[model samples]
Target chain A: MRCFRFWPALAVISLAACTTAFPQAPNYGNLGRTPSKEEIQAWNQAIGPQGKELPPGSGTAKQGQEIFANKCAACHGPAGEGSQLAPRLVGGRGALNIPTPSRTLANYWPFATTIWDYINRAMPPKQEGSLSASDIYALTAFILYRNDIIPEGQVIDATSLPKVKMPNRDGFIPQRLEDIHDLRARGCGAGHCP
Target chain B: MSSKRSLRRQFLKNGAALAGFAAGAISSPAGKLFAADAPSADLHAYGQRSHFENDVRIGSLAMWPIVPGARRDYGFRSPLQDSMGIITPAPLHFIISHGHEPPDIDPREHRLMIHGMVDRPLIFTLDEIKRLPAVSRLHFLECHGNSAAAGPTGEPRKALAATVQDTHGLTSCSVWTGVPLALLLGQVGVQKGANWIVAEGSETGKHSKSIPLEKALDDCLVVYGQNGEALRPEQGYPLRLLVPGWQGINNVKWLRRIYVVDQPYMAMMESTKYPSARLDGKSRWFESEMGPKSVITRPSGGQQLGARGFYEITGLAWSGGGAVRRVEVSADGGRTWKDAQLQQPIAPKAHTRFGLAWTWNGEEAVLESRCTDDQGHVQPTLAGLNKFWGIDADYYRLPPATADMGNFNAIQPWRVSRDGSVSNALL
Candidate 1:
């Protein structure tokens, strides 16, 4: 059996010698070929409807400060004042029902993931979606700080960002399942969602 | 241009002489009077107002005003401050759209086609539509996103940049004369499998909505005439769908087609963009009915209070669900509530005006009004709403489920100061 294997190896070596383009395909135009499974898997990372596609590489809040100042501060303002150009990102933690002159994400924005997904898909304006995985991690950390979730020197990354609790995260209730029966039972009228 | 200029000069010159003659004739008395010579409907032509109004007016000629900007995605706001009474005048109502220019539809060439799951898929001409059994009602049609503003919080609440009219002004009520959708469905004979009817507009990409067939047969209408005249161009001239108590989008404008199906069409209006409240962590969709809401038109923001004398706090309250039974006013914040007087004969799905007498103490206090519809649904407080529906959700249609269900009916308090500045107390 060993002798037969050696013979096959020898045959393959000879076959390679017969081709003119030894490490390259001679038919380059046919290069519209499917990539190998491994190659496809490497770039298929995406966070999705089920929260399964998160990529690797975590960062911290301290690192996030650097990322925010460098990439986000210009448009959102140094203190997140928000401009006609872009919306303010933080501050105003409890202005929901007070006679204050200001409000920000700290008082409103319902979901933490909304922040993450928004930044991931649309932030770093000049080069949206161009932030590296680590850059996103760091930026998330910085914003959480500005929102006053985590203090200075706190490091945010995949692990900590998801765990960091948010106010008003549970503000909305799921839509009630209603049909003709429900509508009639409820005496469907204006203001009532039937 | 030259002819117009000459006509104006001639009219001015003759008008002066005519005025002199009329003045002399009236002085002489009897049959000499020019009262009978006043302009009549024959001389004035159609579309002219019988009486002049001091209030700001727009789009009077076409029945609908053309918004200043041509971009279909944008529209003009209604002049809420300038308007009087509960019913927003047809011309001053805010007009919003989604990428559809005004269509030049000919009623003679138009046909409202009812198809899909039906015993008889029939196409009715504009005349045939008018001839069908008709029912008229005075109701209000409002946009779900009408009050898009920057909330007292940092997040945008009523986002509209225009006046309260722009934000809350896209509402109107008129005697709509047309065939009841129920009668039409009876005529067409909707099949048992038909549960949803998708209303289509003439504008491309803007046509489509899935409405429950039962609801359609109940209160929907194929409206033609508005305010005793044919529908205006901006108001879906020729024809439009009126789903009573439903969101404005459900009432498709420039309606061109109707498709009945067992399942919802899953159109863009239903799948995405409409606001839904989140409850217990799930998103709601296709919420058509607007909640009971009220706006204190008088003493509203930007209005000047000349003095601290007793003044009437007057405003309009309406519910897409039903008639507004009562509206409560809180002059000292939400601490105490007193019922405001509701105007007589409150009709269902109509704008009912409410008034209350208040004596300003010339102190910084909160003034708020909360409406309770016939359905017994009370208005939620801003703080209570913020607990579940973050002020920054960007979507007002459906709020999310949160630990803050306890805050559902928090009183929406408005702060008023001696300086006459009125703002949300929940700043």
Candidate 2:
């Protein structure tokens, strides 16, 4: 088989079949169908630390203060100090080493892109995915600013979000094959699954 | 034959069931009914457990930092003290909500989309997935945070004054039925260099996890059946991922998407919430796989042992590494130990029942059980586990600083008080 980088779109299954499919199980050929691009877009919303999947549009904390107060303050509290119902989003900046470090975004999250991706996909609780891209960017900037990670005027978008390094970027133990319990001797090693 | 008798008189309805018992400490199952008083013979088409069996899971949103409005930040535990055998009743299986509730979706309409870093991105209807070759195997699903006690490192899981049900009930096993995920990936022809796959669910929060492709290709499954029937709504209903022996979060319920990628996605659950913080402040990520552990269920906490002369000590033992090789029970704390008989079929990655006849002298004796898996890893003492996490075996009692703990497989000790009552002895 030839090696090539393939960008996938849904419903593209009718391109015949992959001869290499079904090596372990019986050749129960053609059981599933190629899905439409819309179906793919509906569920495959993953954005890694690189923020490569981040979309267009941008906003600053100046624009976010209003959005957060209107949409988030009820559960997260004013200025994201956290409330009885929800956890804190900002502040907890130099506390990762404490016995019980307050895992606010400032001290725990390893990537700024994760914050953007999380808000974009699941924010405002029950009314998730309802916010505009600009609204999400503003909210992210507002959180970063509150944690003193970025200035209130810093514009956040696909480009700037990836560059905003996280405070606890190196807080996590690096992934190692032998380190993954019960996975030793399995095909996984050195961050690759062979 | 009893119709001629007076309807007012009661009869031993379960005489045959009672006949199976030889009658040492056994009494008729506390149920008495006359033939005439029997209810209309609906036969309970769905089949209900005997009214005498009222075991229920513990769902408490009141478990610290109560998030009231959404009610989504909650989970339920199985009644382990009341559990029997290997299979956890489908209805009583433990649940971890993780900020999302089970969604309602028709099996016909629900589709599992498999895309990204593949030669053929495929979508399978529930029927289509079911149409493939299927295998049924028993496996246990345990949360990483199961069985943690309040210890010196921090206020982790629970207070010492909790029942075995409350302490170790977050785990349950089932005979899951479905096609292997390798079969599905085999059909998709996974692209070279793809090492991880992000499994997403249909919940409102889209409950998701990034799993190693090695695991998916090994024994992971797209199961739609549990025990002997279709999956329960709470157990992912029409479809779920079964990552055998791994921590429960990776077994995404109501599975919807499988996006193969080159590296970890580091989603919110994986990045910020699930990592276990070490004593040194650095945390471990993706440290799945529950280690070898066992706990005595009977004569456990909350239950009173009336006349504990010939009480049998029994509980469950399991390991993510392999089958339970052996289980040793200790009557006088860890000072002495004796091998317990392991009930069959002693399968890997599933609950193995172990028990032994004990003529309790009925003093204030402490009881504990430790298991060694087929991989030869012995279950660690609470102190040994603490030491493994960098240091300490005694209860130095520092206020628990963090919430997320990695794999809490420490041995649990139960104290049998002189009053014939059992309680948690971890303190």
Candidate 3:
């Protein structure tokens, strides 16, 4: 009986020792590993509004015209007028106020960085993310020129792309929490909230 | 003992007699089997129906705009007119993609990386993510541009099926299970001053969108389970970011990465595609939450009532703000409405079933349903919503003169003719 009682006390002490062994360890469910820098660089290709992550490259509209005809015209059409598969990238200037606004890059886009970012990630739809940095800059320059946003001979690079002012730069009103709360309250009643 | 017959011989005689009796019973007229009705082909081991079940999804006979050599555009309309309850069958759920076929992704190779502006950047394989603490909730995923065809002129086609398909088919609801995004964010430890999180897909288009960090941490989920099963391929298979009660586009499918950032990415979709222009000439971006809406499914359109008698008018009602408090059904259009019986278990931000017993007279009548949510928001009529948005004569003359198809929650009207033909009401 004495031996049995001693064994129970010994087991309790061991359990306490086990608990104290890992006192300050943070539990992340011990799942998933930290990614390497190379892995991060390969996937972290998105460009923001301020051109923070833009790669170093430069291209002129003249260089971009050839690339556009060879790789993009099949979908975007000649002169970026658009085709059945893709949308028009140029023209439609001052059409936002018309009865049927043709929202092209010239009339609708607010930021030039978005144009470069979109093309870099999603252009040539089938073979996306396949364009070289210089090719992307050239395409961006060509599109901006076609939209009449930049001068004909101006070259576009990481620095100049963010400087180009778009037609609808001030068009959007960022939605606020109050707007959503109010919309829920009034439910878009007649002559009420919008 | 008296006859001295062997026990084995007696057993054989009894077995033969039993077999004969069973054959006689099976051959009786009452128990006759219609062998001809059985399919000639063998039934599948898992499950399959006979070829005679011709109830298939409707497909466009020909392409529109005729983009030669372009990706095939596949559009399937859910048979809403024939839907039975709140849960749409997985196969019949409506599909609206970017015309390109859904990329075939192997779940084993998929990885969800959380990086940028975080204390500890982490990449979780599909298996590792599934091992985290999970939650299940019912939510409705609606394309913000779902009812774009419900313009002032109405659908050009006279068929009621066309109206249902075009107006309300883009929305669907399901019970989803996944790890709360906040759980993952806490694990990575978001850095200070981070305002937005960009969710990117692995599709050919590399579709991506920027979402407010507040919204991402609130109730967003890294979902992999749908309707108690693995996520469907069309629905972002191995992983998808489910922004509950938000526009479908924000719920990026085939999710591959999450980037915690200091500013909105100004992606193509958010900048140009989803924003809607207002009467003031300024566009409204990030109209994320779906508005309160309701639709009459049964007796809605196309289906004709054989005899006008006691009929139960039933449909679906939901609101992004919260639970639906009440649903009112009107037999004479908006002139009058009676509160319908709301089905039980009315979950928040989910479809609520409602029904009303109506006695249909032989005279022509207009049927409609209006829903009010817990947030005191009542569903609006088309005219009411149009006026509320201030789309005046001049506004119509401007670009996007069509009805505010985006976020349109107008009361749907179903006109029942005297001859039992039901069609979409012009009102």
CA-lDDT, candidates in order: 0.57, 0.75, 0.71
Task: Give the per-residue Cα lDDT of candidate 1 at B342.
Answer: 93
Tens digits of per-residue lDDT, candidate 3, B142-235, equal 7776654333313322234334544576677788889999989888989998888999998777788888888898899999998888887877
TM-score (C-alpha) between model 1 and the true structure: 0.58
lDDT of 3 at B214: 86
Cα lDDT tens digits for candidate 2, B74-136 = 357787876779899999999886646578989999999999999988999999988888999
> Model 1: how large is the Cα RMSD against the reference?
20.9
Candidate rank order under TM-score = 2, 3, 1
- In candidate 1, position B112 carries an lDDT of 73
lDDT of 1 by residue, B1-427 (tens): 1233324333432342233222111110001112222345664466444343323221112111222321123334454544456666666555555534567899998767776567666667787777655777877777665553332111222322122333355566666778788776665567776667878777534446768887898888999987777888878889999987777788888887777666554443443345343433333345567778777665554344545667787777777778889999988777898899998658888878888998877787677888999889777666545554555333333332211111122344445667654544444
Encode model 1's per-residue lDDT on A78-131: one tens digit a residue. 767664445567775643332222324665444344456456544554354577
Model 1 stretches astray by more than 4 angstroms: A1-194, B1-43, B47-75, B148-163, B275-282, B388-414, B424-426
Best by lDDT: 2
Model 3 gets an lDDT of 0.71
Query: For model 1, what is the alpha-carbon lDDT of residue B91?
Result: 64
| Candidate 2 accuracy as TM-score | 0.85
Candidates in order, TM-scores: namely 0.58, 0.85, 0.83
